[model samples]
Target: MAKFAVIGHKGRMGQALATAIEEAGHEFCVGIDLGGDPAPVIGQCDVVVDFSSPDALVGNVKAARSKGVPILIGTTGLEEAHFSAIDEAARDIPILQTGNTSLGITLLSALVKQAAERLGDDWDIEVLEMHHRMKVDAPSGTAKLLGEAAAEGRGVALDDKMDSGRHGQTGARTPGDIGFATLRGGTVAGDHSVIFAGNEERLTLAHSAENRMIFARGAVRAGGWLIGKPPARYTMHDVLDL
Candidate 1:
C-alpha cells in the first residue's frame, strides 16, 4: 500500500482526505497542519496531497521535491507565482495541480471545452459557481477551471478574455468573452454551471457536488495514480484520461 501525507491536516478537506486514504487501503503516513513543517515527514510518504492555503504552497512543493515524492495539490486561490513554483518543482518531481478534484467536474470541463468548440462566436459563454460561506476566493476555482476549458476550446487566453465582477454601467457584453458569476452561502460543497447563450436558445452544463467526499476520493485516486510517474506537471485530465 502507498503511504500518503496530507498537508493542512486540520481543515475540512484534510480530514476528508484522511478518511479517503484509509478507505482506499492506503496508509496515512503523516498530516501536517498550520505551523507544522512537511519537510520533516515528506520523505516517509510515497505521495503527498495538499489542501492547504496558498501561502504554504511553495514550501510544500519544495518539501515534496526534496524528498522526490510526487505531490497532488488541491489548494485553490493560487496566484501566478504559486504556479511558477509548482512548475519549477515539477521539473524534479511529478506534480498535479487542479482547482477542483471531483471526477464529475473533470468530466464537466471536457464537455465545456467540446461545447465551446462546436458553438459559434455568437453564443455568449457565462460561468456560475457557488461555494460555502467560508470560502475566501471569489468565482471559485472550479469556475475558473471551466472558463479556462472554454477558452482553450476557443483558442484564446482566459486571462485576456475573462470578464468577471460586472457592475454599474458595464455597457453591452463583449463578443467571445467568457463571463463569471459567483455565489456564496450555507455550507455548499460546490456547484458550477456553464451557460452558452445563443440567439434564442440557451444551453447550460452543470455539476453539483453533494459532499466533500467526492473531492477527497478523487484526490486519493489521483495521488495513487501519480506514484512512480515521471516528473512533470499534471492535471486531473491526466488522471481521468479525458
Candidate 2:
C-alpha cells in the first residue's frame, strides 16, 4: 500500500483525509500542520496530500519535489502565481490540484460543460454556492470550477466572462456573462448550483456535499493513483478519467 502525508493534518479536511487513508488501507506517514515543516519526513512518503492554505502551497510543493514525490493539493484561494509555482514544481514531480475533489462534483462539471455547449448564449449561466461559516474564501472554489467548465464549453476564458461581486446600480444582466453568487453561515459542508436561464425556461444543475468524507476519500484515491506517475500537472478529471 502507498504511504501518504497530510499537510493540513490539524484542519477539517486534513483530519478527514487521515481517517480516509486508514479506511482505504493506506499508511499515513506524517501529518504537517500550518506552521510545521514537511521537509523533515516528506521524503519517506510516496505521495503528499495538502488541504492547507494557499500561502503554504509553494513550500509544500518544493519539499515534495525535493524527494521526487507526487502531490495532490486541495487548497483553495490560490492566485495565478501559485499555479505558476505549481507548474515549475511539476517539471520534476507529478502534481494534481483541484478546488473540489468529490466524485459527484467531478461528474457535475462534465454535465455543466455539456449543458453550456448544447444551450445557446441566450441562456444566461449563473453559478451559486454556499459553505459553512468557517470557510474563509468567498465564491467558494467549487463555484469557480463550475464557472470554468461553462467558460471552457463556450470557448471563453473565465476571467473575461465572469461577473462577480455585483454592487449597487448594477445594470441589466449582460448576455454571455457568467454570474456568481456566494453564501456563508450555518454548518453546510458545501452546496453548488448552476442555473441556465432562458427567456422561457430554466435549467438547473446542483450538488450538495453532506460531509467532508467525500473530498477526503477522493483525495486519498487520487494520492493512490498518483503514485509512480510521470512528472506533470494533473486534475481531478485526469484522476477520474473525465
Candidate 3:
C-alpha cells in the first residue's frame, strides 16, 4: 500500500482525497491544513497530493522535493509564477498538475480539441462554468483549461483571444474570440459547458460534477500511478492514459 500526505486537509477536496486514499487501500501519512506543518510527515509519504491554495504551493513543493517524492497538485487559481515554480520543482521530482482531475473532464478536453479543430473560427467559441459560492476564483480553472483546449485546436493563444466578461454596452462579439462566463451559488460541485455558435447551428459540450469524490478518487489514482515515475511534469491525461 502507498502512503500519501493530503495538503489542505480541512478543505472539501482535501477531505475527499483523504477518504478516497483510504478507500483505495492506501494510508494517509499526514493531513496538513492551514498552519499545519507538512514537513514533519513529508518524508513518510510515498507521494504527496496537493489540493491546497496557491499561497501554500511553493512551500509544499519545496518540502516534497527535499524528500524526492512525487506530487500531484490539484490546486487552482495558479498564476504564471506558480507554474514556473512547479516547473523548477519538476526538475527534481515528478509533478502532476491539472485544473480538474475528473476522468470526464479529461475526455471532454480531448473532444473539445477535436471539435475546435474541425469548426472554423467563424463558429465562435465560449466557455461557461459554475462552482460553489465559497470558491474564490472567477472563470474557474476548468474553464481556463477548456479555453486552452479550444485555443489549441484553433491554433491560437487563449490569452490573446479570450473575452473574459462583458459589462454595460459591450459592442459586437469579437470574431475568433473565446468568451468565458462564470457563475457562483449554492453547492455546485462544478459545471462547465463549451459552446460553438455558428450562423445557423450551435453545439454545446458539457459536464456536471455531482460531487467532489470523482476528483478525489482520480487524484488518489494519479498519485498511485506516479510512484516510481521519472521526475517530470504530468497531467490527468497521463494518469488516465487519455
For model 2, give the 10-residue run with minimal summed lDDT: 33-42
Clashing residue pairs in candidate 2 (N, C-alpha, C atoms within 3 angstroms): none
**For model 3, what is the error of residue 90's alpha carbon versus the real structure, in angstroms, after optimal superposition?**
0.7
Model 1 poorest 10 in a row by lDDT:
36-45
Q: Check candidate 3 and list the clashing pairs.
A: none
Candidate 2 on 152-178: residue-level lDDT in tens?
999999999999979999989888999
Candidate 1 off by > 4 Å = none
How many clashes (backbone atoms < 3 Å, residues ≥3 apart in a chain or on different chains) does model 2 have?
A: 0
**Cα RMSD, model 3:** 1.0
Specify the highest-lDDT model's number.
1
lDDT by residue for model 1 (1-242), tens: 99999999889999999999999999999999988889978898899999999999999999999999999999999999999999999999999999999999999999999999999989999999998899999888899999999999999999999999699999999998999999999999999999999999999999999999999999999999999999999999999898
List the candidate 2 regions with Cα displacement exceeding 4 Å.
none
Tell me the whole-model lDDT of each prediction, alpha carbons only: 0.95, 0.93, 0.92
Residue-pair clashes per prediction, in order, are 0, 0, 0
Which residue pairs of candidate 1 clash? Answer: none
In what order do the candidates fall by lDDT, top score first? 1, 2, 3
